[model samples]
Target chain A: MQKLTFPRMGESWRTFKMLLEDLGNEVVVPPRPSKRTLDLGVRYSPEFACFPLKILTGTYLEAIEMGADTIVTSGGIGPCRAGEYAMLHHKILADLGHNIKMVVFEPPRFYPFNFIKNVYILNRARHSIRGIIALIKKAWRKLQALDNAEKLSHVIRPRELITGTTTRVYRKGLEWIDQAYTNEQIIDAETAALEALRNVPQNPEAEVLRVGIVGEIYVLLEPASNLEIEETLGNLGVEVERSMFLTGWTRDNTWTETTEGMTVKAAAEPYLPELVGGHGRDSIGNTILCAKRGFDGMIQLAPFTCIPEIVARTILPKVSRDYDIPVLTFFLDEQTGKAGMTTRLEAFVDLMRRKKHFRQGNGLLTG
Target chain B: MKAYLGIDVGSVSINIVVLNEAGEVITGLYLRTKGRPIEVIQEGLKQTAESIPPDVKIAGVGSTGSGRYLAGIMVGADVIKNEITAHAVAASMVIPDVQTVFEIGGQDSKIIIMRHGIVTDFAMNTVCAAGTGSFLDQQASRLNIPISQFGELALKSTSQVRIAGRCTVFAESDMIHKQQMGHQIPDIINGLCEALVRNYLNNVGKGKEILPPIAFQGGVAANVGIKAAFEKALGFPIIIPKYFNVMGAIGAAQIACEEVSRKGETSFKGFQITNLPYRTGSFECDGCSNVCEVVEIFEGEKVIGRWGSRCSKWDITGENK
Candidate 1:
């Protein structure tokens, strides 16, 4: 059996574990992403590269050093920088004198020869369908459980608490879920984990304003991208409801719904009707959905040079006006500072509270 | 009367433009996305609903930008097009012979080359930050100045200082060094703007066939210093359209109009999209060597949309299986 190693993105650990378990091979867990990983990435990568590219470069390098023979990565063909990340990373790694074979899953367009090569890889792996299905089911169950647990924790945790424990439990639950085979086992593990986590006791009367976060997956999920915006928001007594979670994004990307009704019910409205080539649809749809859910405000966070989120920013004002909600946009890069962001968030929240108070005073609270 | 709704969801903001059937912008809303695109769209829609006349019929909807897929789903957009196409359409509507377009938004910057009223080639900066609105905003904040005042400050400069503007880090350090060396604030600011223009030209505008009749749009076009610097560098007066900030939305709306006019119908999901229960989830795909982290959206029991599939195996057919 060929030793397969995968680069770590958010929540990728769980998926890799499950895949290795199914393949009857020992999974070599790469080290958690850290500044060292970033440093190594920067050292080996070309300057002016995007954050994801730098991180992936580091991950691949680390995995190769750990004796992993094959590395897998995804590719895209779009206006977004991600479309070129795979090729660039390949060149960087090759130039760095690493000979580990890379398997890049090609996007819909661009580089026709690469696309054909990817098709061959998929066809060769056709025999692994059962394992894939089982792995996906297990991964889905774990993710759903983790999401539910985290959501509950947000409602119950102390106002000052970062809910890092919830994230920790979620990670553990995912680990257990990956190891579990049967549905019953997965459920059993989830229930036990949920019960144990609930028993830990949290401040029941915590009052935190909910803030919905929507934007590119990297900026939303990666802590460094948005200067740990979720943590910052949480610290400011704002419960963060990020629109893009690893589980949902993966399911939507992989699962095909048979019924139109199912599709309508399960899929986000903005991304529906068609896959329109970028995160623009998801960002806009998620923004509207978040507003309707009574979030106090919306925050659209993106990288310094993200194209899609800029488009979302252009139209968010109408959404804010229609929903009577406030939306703040934050564009982050390596140069962004903590103080500036905090000030902006503080001003936004203060305005929101003032508006709420004014409405209550006017007896306009009733819809 | 038929109305059209156009939404542009960019990296830094979400803009909405409502147009009458006659193709004139009736009302436009510009708001920052602030990390919640879903809420932004909903809020934008609600505002449009309240501001526009109740009797005005929304006959078509269009979405563009990085978030167009999401925006289309949110507004049930009748047409979804790329930013270049949408921008081109809108630019053409405003300036028929728009030979070049220099768009600097909050996050990214793009240079569109057009010949004979058609896009010939284009280049975009998705990696650098020197010429973006956010960069200027950061520099302004660092200087303890309002972003709105940045342009005026640059204009006030009597002397030009050269600051490294190829990247954000180097630019900041260079500015700090110049400031410590007793350089006036205006000079430093103007130098920064000049550096940004130089960086943009070297990066995004490199090797492109730049021509006259160029129109500058997007949020960054609001900066007079950058605009002036562009003119100085290009040796041509760059036209700043009245609706520069919302040009993407206008373009999206124009595309929507074309789609609706051509089809004679619309696929807009109507206002009910505001009421739908939507959820998102993501999981890593270890099916093959490629571990694709797929994002899925659910309304309830049904799966409506999916993305983050690098191979297009999951997205091309819209079928999970």
Candidate 2:
């Protein structure tokens, strides 16, 4: 069996690990990307490559260094830069003298044969179709559990009386979920962890603000790259709701499952008119939904020079005016300073708080 | 007899202002920063102390501009704000119904859109000198005229001369080429002014609605040529407040006053800090791949403040963690 590895994008890492491990392949998990990881990516990556691409390359290099002989990553199609990442990554790694097997899963319609062949290779340990089906079911259950626990953390963190308590509990919950081998254990751990989170002292009467965070998936999910915006917002007594979840996105993309029925494309139809590549449409749709749901404000986080996000940014002001909601957009780069970020956040929160107060005074609060 | 002190330390200039409880400017001073923020601030403070009445107490202190953090720590400011907020606040204070503000500083420029006295939208120039005062200063020197007289020269233009003001390099070359063409100096100067206003509206003010009751203030507000150019371009005269050049400092003072009222106390270090043996030093921390340059400020042998690290491992204050 080949040693397989994948970059830690979000909760997707655990799902991939379970899937590959169940298939009898030795899965090597790269440590979470850090400053060192970013440095490795910066050192070898093309100067003009997007921030997420550089980080992904860095993770691959780290995984290879950790003795992983095979790389499995998703591939995009069309105008999005993501489509070229896998091929460029393979070439770059080879140039750096690391010869590793690379498997990129493109959309089934685009490369069905290659996708099936890759699956067959991964299923070397348990070749039976029934075994593969059962294995996938278990992994899917784990993904749900992981997503639920993460969602709970986002809600609880802002209302917690003690600073960092919810975060600590969430970290422990993640570890518990990671260690669970069976579907039953995963469900058990998820329930017990959420219960533990409930026990954390929380201020029931605390006047908290709800902020919806929407933007590029990688930047939104990766805490280090975004300077831990969710944690910072939570600290400032704001409840954060992410517009994207890894499990939901992956499931929807793979199985065409429409849980909400209200797709981002549909929501953004009036404003965006057409889908531009990347998360631009999603950002607009999510922000509009957040406003309709009575969120006090919205924050858009995207990498500097991200074209799709820039388009979304230009249109956000009109949305803000229409919805009577405030939106703050931050363009992150290597030179982004924490001080500047904090100042902007502080000002934005202040604006939202005042707006909420003014609206409440005008008797607009739903009784 | 209580007043708030506001300090605006920017790349090219440092402005210090004193404001009383009525939000009236008591005294204001503008000085060139010249790459020495600490020294310039101290000098400004010394001059402020000497100018102001002895009985007036400093109730609060605020710092704004790019070096806001450093100035905030140095002065023990009660409020530290960004230039956008400061500019908006000052503009709104001067003209209560101000809907738009165009602030062009020494090396930076910004546009603020206001609604009912609240800053609703804003944009700042991203590392571009084309729409800022520095470019005008450079051109003034290159044309063998003092910066103070540059605006007057611009006002004397007889014919329209177009100067490309996309980038600083191209603008300089374009200016020289126009000069070789024998267009009068004033025409070139006026053209440069119009070009700058055009660049500002195209870039910083891009996609932003430019509503009426606009107030233009900054270090660059003193340039009547730019003001006239803006008036011509927007087809409306802009309100340049009496304390135009020192608006950022005034805004900082206003925010500081509000902060003091809310907190019921002040963190102001007092003007006597001018006499203190204060110094700043920085060292690169190799503990992580980030290579954060940790800057530390000292009051004699005692380390006062530290910042610039992504992680606060080297922060001596113990507050960051």
Candidate 3:
């Protein structure tokens, strides 16, 4: 059996490993990306590469050390430099003298022969094509369930009476989803997770500010990369509306069109009509939608030196001005300090809270 | 007399302020931090305590600035706030209808937009802090002039020269080149001030509507050349508050006042803390490769509080969570 592994991509690692395991491969899962992983990557990768690139490189190295014989991950294409990540990672690994196999998964519709070879030949899928299709469908459902649980946590965390309750419950919810094998079990797990989050002792009357989170998909989805921003904001009494979910991202990236694709594009049409590269257009579109929906504020996150998000960030001030919604664009990198991020987040939330108070009261808050 | 005390321990300076029940500044002291925040804060408190009336009771205490947490625990602050909110509160209190606030401190600069006494939007210098007060301070000393006289020298300039303020390295090199070409020192300083102002507005003040009646505070506001450059750029004369150097402390004091009035009790540890022996120490936590540098506050061998951990595993508060 080919020892297969994939780089950590947010919380999807658990579900992804399960999918690979059932597909007739011994999955070698690396520990979730942490400081050690980041340091390992930074030591080898180019100094000015995108944050995700360095992180992914480190993850692959750790997986190799853990006995992963094959690395599998999707490829990207566009103005963003992510399109070259797999090639560069492979080169870097080879230069380090590790002769492991690297499989770059392209969209099946566009690269059918390569897809079949990866699935049926190298991966050795034990089931019929139809059965494999059903398995993928099941995995997709599980992922959707996990994403749902995560979204629910964003809503429940702010109102939770006991600090850290939502975080514990969310972890339990992920564990349940991971251990689930059947479709009904996945559904039950999601229901149970949401139910537990709802059952968390909470002050429902807690006034929460709605803030939309927009930016590069990697930073948005990866908890470590963004430093558990969602949790931090939630603990500070802000409800977050994440711009991208894996389901929507998977759908849009596949040959099939997504329901959210046209809407996001149309929303971004007035501000940024063309795709600058990598989620740049979508970020602008989501900010506009948030403004129209009357969100109190939105914070844009991007990797340091991220071109696409930088392009989006430069145009965001106009959007913030025209819509009367506050926008805070922040970049993430190795040097980003927890203290600085906390101060900014606290100050932004305070600004929003004071703004709301002022709008609700007529100069009565001067006290 | 009931009073609220605010302590601002920043990267370069420590400011302590006391406000009366009417929110008026009773005593304010600004002292150089010199990389020792703990000692400076205690000394500042001692100085303020001595300057104020003996009967002025400190009803509440608030801490702010970068070292807010450290200062908060040491002084038993009722409210620990970020610098932005503190500055906004102080600005609006001083200039009732203040529309804009420009705060240039030691390591960072920020622009706050306000409407109807509320902060609408704000931006801080990120990634690159090229145009902050520390940079100006360095340039002034490099020119063999005291920082206090750097601005006055600039105001005496009779010519204009362009200095690259995009990066500090480039700005310093350009200043040297201008000096080699025999450009007047006053003109060069004036050019540097204008360049710094342009960079600040372009970077931190980008896309924000900088309306008039702006209030310029923070330590950097002491530079008249920077003030002139700001006026030239925005075409509006900015008002420097009475307690410009200690505005952050004033804001923290006001916020504390409001908090104590609402809660009907104070958490003030009082002027006695200045007489106590307090120390801060940090150690790395080997929790899952994060290696978080957890800082702990101690009072005479007793651990008082711990912070700076990502997972918050080391967030110990002595007897309480």
Candidate 4:
């Protein structure tokens, strides 16, 4: 039996596991990144690697301990160091004397003999190509449903009458998604989750500050990495619209690359003409779009020492000045204190609120 | 007389202030925390009670700084705010048209940019402490010079030598190297001030427009050498507020006044809290991987508030449940 496992990412890990299990493979799902995972990862990995790399290093190690022989991960084709993550993980694991197989699914543009070999290793079930396509399509549907459910919860969270109601419903929704064994189960889970989210009582009379979050993908998606910032903002009565949802990010990569997510590229092109690697371009572009859409402010969350985000951070001040919006850039690391994060976020929210009120007052005076 | 009490409990010092209805300072006191906040808070409250007349009534209370939550719950604060907002509020009162506020305390540094009485943007130093009050304090103590007189010695320097202020380790080594180079003490201290100012501008004050009518406050603002270095860097005179060191408490007092008048009631726990034995304890909740440390506050055998847990299972204060 070919036992398979993958790094734990956002909620997409559930769908990824379901896809592998449907392919007649035993899948080991690593537990969520905890204090132990972080400590172990930091102990082994270079101290300078970005937080995502460290977290992934920890996740893969946990999965290895859970009895996995093969690791399947994606490859990137950008100036960003994310492209080298899989190779780095392979080397780091090997240096520690664990000789397990690593199946790297590179982007389609670089498809060659290695890609074919990796594919052959993955086809342990020996299913037909059409059967594989059908299974992949099934997994993609679940991905969209989960992202939509999560997106809906964001709108309801800031306005929810009772604190933590949206979070509870969303978590339960993910559990239902996890329990899915077929297409019907996925639909039922998504519908029930969406219904529960809408059913959350909200204060319609309350006004909320609209803030846009743009940053690196991992920190944006993972709650543990960013310290649950999306939920934190929502509870503080701010409507958060994030730029990088896995639905769009995954849709634009690999063999199924499409023009759907390229709009962010165009949006960011005026400020950052070239891809400096990572999500740097996407971050700038999203901030411009958010400003044009009349968001009260913008926040960029980057892992500490992330080269691309640091490059984007320099250009962001100009974007803020031109767009007439306030931008707050935060670097995430293990040393980041919870109290300090809350203090900065609270102060930023207060700034946004005051500026918004001043703008409205000016509008009323003139209009 | 009616008074609004404001307490700022920080890492190094605790400041207590009483402001009357007109926002005039009736009394202000400063005490060292010495790593024992509970004892320091009770001592400060007791001293304030003793200093003021018996007829004077504390109509409202507020708290700020890193220990704001603990201080707030202990005294039943009407307003609890972060150090940034509190400092900004206090500075605006001193310099009404203040465009920029530079605050460097013991453990952290921050820059607030304000336009037309609204804070437009702000930035705080990262996890690095190479450019804060504590940085100077450590160097002063190491050099056998009192912190109060360190700045005066720097002002008497004739020549300057640069020190790397990006990290404390590098800066300390660089200072020693300059010392071995046979440079005078005053010149090296002056160079250290400039290095700290450079680091502060490069990090905390990065991309911030430091327009004039700038107010520099906090514990570090007491250093005339740093003040001069700041002026040299920006080419503008900096305004040090009258209550530069205790501005957080002053701002808290001001905010307390506003909050109390608006609510028409005060939650000030009274000076009698000094007599009550308040106990605080913390435990590690191994519920999951997060390993959140939960803190509980007790008032004479009765649990008052509990927080610091991610799951909110043990959180009694709705702060982070």
Best-to-worst ranking by DockQ: 3, 4, 2, 1
Model 1 misplaced stretches (Cα beyond 4 Å): A1-367, B316-321
| Candidate 3 DockQ vs. native | 0.55
True contacts kept of 2: 0.08
- When candidate 4 is compared with the true two-chain complex, its DockQ is 0.48
Docking tier of model 2: it is incorrect
**Native contacts matched by each model:** 0.00, 0.08, 0.57, 0.51
lDDT tens digits by residue: candidate 2, A301-328? 9987788898999999888889877888
Query: What TM-score does each model's chain B reach against the true chain B?
Result: 0.95, 0.96, 0.97, 0.97
Q: Model 3: residues >4 Å from true position, as ranges? A: A362-367, B316-321
Q: Considering summed lDDT, which 10 consecutive residues are worst modelled in model 1 chain A?
A: A358-367
The TM-score, computed over Cα atoms with residue i paired to residue i, of candidate 3 is 0.96
Candidate 4, TM-score of its B chain: 0.97
Task: Estimate the lDDT of model 1.
Answer: 0.70
State the lDDT of candidate 1 residue by residue for B162-227, as single tens digits.
999878999999999999999999999999989999999988776566788999999988889988
Per-residue C-alpha lDDT of model 1 across residues A297-321, encoded as one tens digit per residue:
7888866656677676666656666
Would you estimate the TM-scores of all the predictions?
Answer: 0.51, 0.89, 0.96, 0.96
First chain TM-score, candidate 4: 0.95
* Each model's Cα RMSD: 19.2, 3.7, 2.1, 2.5
- Return the lDDT, model 2, position A277: 70
When summed lDDT is taken over every stretch of 10 residues in candidate 4 chain B, the lowest stretch is: B312-321
lDDT of 4 by residue, B1-321 (tens): 999999999998899999888878888888888999989999999999998888889999989999988898899998877888888888888888899999999889999998887788899988788878778889999999999999899899998789888999999999999999999999889999999999999999988888989999989998999999999988999999888899999988888888777779998889999999999989999888899999999999988788787654676652321
